[model samples]
Target: MKASALWPMIIILTLIITACSNNDEASEEVDEEDLEETTEITAFMPEHDEMNFEENSFTKLMEDEYNIDFEFETTSWDGTAANERRQISLASGDYPDVYYLIPWVDQFSPSDLIRYGKQGVLLPLNDLIEEHAPNLQAVLDEDEEFRAMATAPDGNIYGVPQLVECFHCTWGNKMWLNTSWLDELDLETPETHEEFKETLMAFRDEDPNGNGEQDEIPLSGSTMTQKESIIPFLMNGFIYDDLETRLLIEDGKVDFAANKEEWRDGLEYIRSLYDEGLIDPGAFTQNADAYMQLGNEEPNILGAAPAVHIQLFTDNDNQYDFDALAPLEGPNAAYSSYTHPIEQGATFALTNKASSAAQIKSIQVLDYMFTEEGSLRAFFGEEGEGWKKPEEGDVAINEDVEPIYVDIPEGEDETLRNDNWAASAQYYHPVEFRDGIVQVEDIYTEEGFERRLQEATYLYEDQEPEDVFPYWGVWYGEDVQDEIAELETNILDNVDQSAVRFITGDLSLEDDWDDYIAGLESLGVERYVEINQDAYDKYLENVE
Candidate 1:
């Protein structure tokens, strides 16, 4: 009772004593507690079906593990206008605490880094990673190109990149034909250019899709989509460096490949096909929607098209209804494919406004996305919680399947029916997560699985050698970006326009061909190549 009554007086006396005394220890303790609190980070990303992983992302797992909180913001993949709205925001200084700008910002720029870093907007991460991060340092140390690409021309790094080894990206234009159609018509896959001509003719005449009327399109494709590569992939095979898929650095300067003479040969092949009714008249004018629609609804209407895999029918993405044939051989007797490297992972840059601790925490959080456990969690989702791990009791899903991830076995492998791709890949998240450890349940329709099996089982004859050519990554100084862009765009426009005229018979390859090459030269084709070559040389020198 005495204590209760005296409590207020005691508290007042204690407060008075605390206020008058030097209470540095208590204040310091309070400050230390505040410093230990988690930092908040916000990231901006362009929207994609794939990009939506952040909410249920691996980063979230890392955040929970490390006690760092990172928030993400996003924008549309493509707007009505082709202009990048995310980039516009970045340039305008409307940056968040962090940005996951894979669409374009992965193409690191020295100028941007200098501008942002000098303004104290982007913190230099070299020290942070050198101390707090070790795995990322291991990646940089092991990969030379990754180092070159990650480091800015100013001798500093501004972003991170993706470095998975992809063998197929370089030589991608090869498409599979419906060999079932060839068999129905008692025809074979084309070998030489002349044979290719005959094959398309038969495809048109044979009505292979089994429709009563002659509505089968012998060959179909688009020049618009990179993956839709019915044109450049084939065209580049014929030309040395034609069809500037993206800018290429040659001996020393920048160049557009589409303007080369071999490109003319490729176009002429297509023109010959077009003139004979073996190609779709709308090959150039058609959009992706139209092409994809035809693939789904009128599977029989299409006899041939451009694609890396049989999935171009994409309707039966998991099915095997279609088969691939090799690219038609050309005049020079050369067959090669130059695959593009998988692009670096998009940027997840720190904002200038982020405090030093915030920046450090932000990168550490990003580093988590690259962790073995983190990548799997972000890419595969919560295992057992979301995915099932493979067991000794069961054949792993991929093993149980016949053809695995488009890599089918030869001879006896085809007859033996195994449903692996469906059981394994199956529109599964994180495609490269391969056959063991984590497993995807084989959950595909019969039609889907069979079609995929059929497609993989079919033979693709005389497939060309894969060419490793130079593809421009954004380690380049922007000194030549404007000109390379201008020249390449103009060359592409002119090439397609002239190609239509030649294919439509309005212009002849023999007559308009020389003029076209000359026109390309006049439009700075040589200059383009020289610029590319120069850039490559400089790029090589810079790497050393």
Candidate 2:
């Protein structure tokens, strides 16, 4: 080979090595810039005591996977204080980039969603749903009921909702009889309303509590929420009592259930129990704490109590003694109080303070929550540590899906195991999703909590009337919202007050019934119905 050729090859090798070194340095510089470019999102949410937000596994996952850090402006779980703080933030224009709310605690009401959305304080999610949230969009598309509830009257989705379709929550007015009392007294479970009345009489007069004194109250409940109210369960035997709405749909028209002839009969029956000292006086006026105290009292003086679930009423060891009574048959009607399965409460809302990048990432974060893996992780926590795949002998609600998971030992502390962000995540555990999960048969311990509820609620299934007024998903327009709200508040307050009076003998059912009806009429109930019916018609148009 020639000397010139060798020299050329050596020069080319040197040039190649130099070029490779420069390329490596450039790549290192780009990596440094990439590391520095992460976006931080600010969020406001109610903080749980068990949650260490900085150390939250879900937050860590999000930061690592998405190159985003969430800085939360939080309030304690106190409902009134949290709400006041949230409102003050809004008024002061110092709110965070996003609001992650617990629907049952301090989330935006549908009316508030509409109001804030229209005022430009809350951003419309239509564009974000179209661009970044395929998971959330899929949910809304598949479930029109959910879509209808989440959407505002002006046809914008102002907030993303917590879509928990807890099957047991659908018929939440079930009465749990102290079957231990029945077993001790040698009484059979009542099948008819009359039989139920006789059993209550026995509980009152016969001293079923074994205390040797007449301390047992035949029936008791609390007025904390309609779910705790006993009237729905007892009155339901006579007429369909839509517990919250107090309205029922028949022949495409909405009518007040409290003023109907069947309602009068139901009230009369409850009055008879009150007159005979069968019903607890505290049941009408007491709060949950007071009611719980009565139930937890020594000697087990309560014969029966109404609640959405026995767990809602008590977590004491005595919760095991109560067994759910099936819907009793009445002469005119036999139905259980039915609530809409879809939870429409807003759990995630984007504020106008969010930057465009923040907006995109916030929606992305929530969209992740709607996925199957995300839902399970947010709800139950990391698999294996918090939950585990079912064994061969384990029973799942649905047998088709693979790798159905059950709660592990750590997941038993349901109140403490999961992170705080899980409570604020937007996700819906629909029937299909919940059905595919594993459920154990044990109800006594915290390990198989869901199993106990599923079994107890089974008795109330298929007992709902076919024509239940779908008031839950209906949205009144801005024009009629105030009028409807004012009217509803007045009417519901009066109805509750009057019911207590009639049940406690402060008012006569036969004489004061017409006046009670007249008072409700005076509260602009006719206009209220008209507004709700219109909203219902509109919702049907959109959903159907």
Candidate 3:
């Protein structure tokens, strides 16, 4: 061979040697111990538009800890069109491996969960929780009521429900009176129906706003939320108005309150208020935005408003003037509406398409979120940047549980905070856990938000009657689920329309009362009662 041929061979050999050396060096750079084999999981979640899940601290922490990469499908926080999207995904059979939802937004109702679970579209979590999720299992072991609510009639937990034991949320339909107006008029908080009536009358008559004009609303409510509606609080003073079920359990039997004479008397009382222009005319149809405008606008046009929390309608300086009104004594009865404190329906679930490994990873991530450290991080954000550990002498809402941390910037925008998970994950903060946390010292600051709420809610707590219905935890069996749903839809619609008609004088309460009762009976109110009674009995039996 010539020297030129030898030169070409030598060049090729040197290039090959260099390539091999570089490859070996690259291989050596990877540390076996540090290498993580990540599993990719797809999830559909509900989120506020401001939240960026990719940059969320909770998501980052979970991904890092579990060695899993997440592909997220996030919908608007309000979830207005999210359900339609979810349904389409379900129908297309292109659903993600997991769903992380906020119940108030788009989430699986118990009926939906049961149906999808039975169809094998959702995976049962009982065995998975036991095998892979010790934290969730521990929660179940500690709270039997939670386990009962989570379990289906078929004896399987198809989805994970959020156990938010919010103390203030249980009796969310209390009224708030502007004490400044009352004091200016030399009136005390009304305790009786007649006294309350007189007070509203005075508010309407007197120019309480000091504008020297009849701009004061006197008494107002919105149809926005049950808490904002005046009917639940006022009507409850007349009968056991379980706001959710709209049916009360009396003498261990289910009874429809809307058709009862007490309910009629309550309507008549409310009608009198409407007739005299005490309640806001727009309260019957206006949304939260309009209702909030009544309280939040300058010059303070509202005299009194019905709400679970004043924050629902007003915030900042506008909220300070209001205080919770005690349940009024009515002709028939006097009681505040009570609710059991468990958010029903499924907030998180694994789809059938998830592989066994993916399922394990999913459960592990959720379990971590349920932990004390993880719960705080998931909700408030990372300790130092998002919040700070409590120092000595810091006061807690309750002294029984040790103080955890106080918020730093306090009330920063969700977009700027690490607590992007919000209600998307399982965050269990029982009364003790919550009360033990350091509260904001300043009532006006963002850190003081929870404390202020706690103080205001304290006045309304324990006002529930002994026999308030536990509708929050009940699940209608599969046999009557569809029927119950249909009946409720029709009955509630009829009742709501009739209530408005009676109040606004669209229908004569005296003349239309019998027809209204008849209408309900025609709509199968009897069967509705029977079905619920059966469910209630079954619920009691199971819980007992």
- In angstroms, the error of model 2 at 243 is 1.1
In model 1, where do residues sit more than 4 Å from their true spots?
1-35, 46-60, 76-85, 102-120, 164-170, 241-260, 314-319, 333-336, 393-469, 542-544
Q: Model 1 residue 156 lDDT?
A: 62
lDDT of 2 by residue, 24-124 (tens): 32222223344345767898988787787778888888877767888978888898988999877765556677888887778888887887777667778
Model 2, residue 433: displacement in angstroms?
A: 2.9
Off by over 4 Å in 2: 1-36, 397-403, 409-420, 436-439, 444-446
lDDT of 3 at 452: 64
Which wins on TM-score, candidate 1 or candidate 3? 3
How well is each residue in 1-544 modelled by candidate 1, as lDDT tens digits?
A: 6988886566445434433332232122223344367766676654543334345445556566655676656565454321255545444555566665543323334455554554445555676678656767776677566666666666666666555433333445556576777788888667777876687788777667776788888778765555465665455457543234434444444545565566667777777677677878767667777777767664467777776555555565422445556555567544445543445323545555565556666666556555655444444445444344444444333454432222222254433222111111111112133333322334244323433332332232224333323443444456776787788688777776776787778888777777877898888877666665665665566556
TM-score of each: 0.74, 0.89, 0.89
Judging by TM-score, tell me the better candidate of 1 and 2: 2
- Per-residue accuracy of model 3 over 462-520 as CA lDDT, tens digit each: 76666656677778888888898999999998998899999999999878899999999
RMSD of candidate 1 to the truth, in angstroms, is: 13.5
C-alpha local distance difference test of each model: 0.55, 0.79, 0.79
How much is 538 displaced in model 2, in angstroms? 0.7
Model 2 weakest lDDT span, ten residues long: 22-31
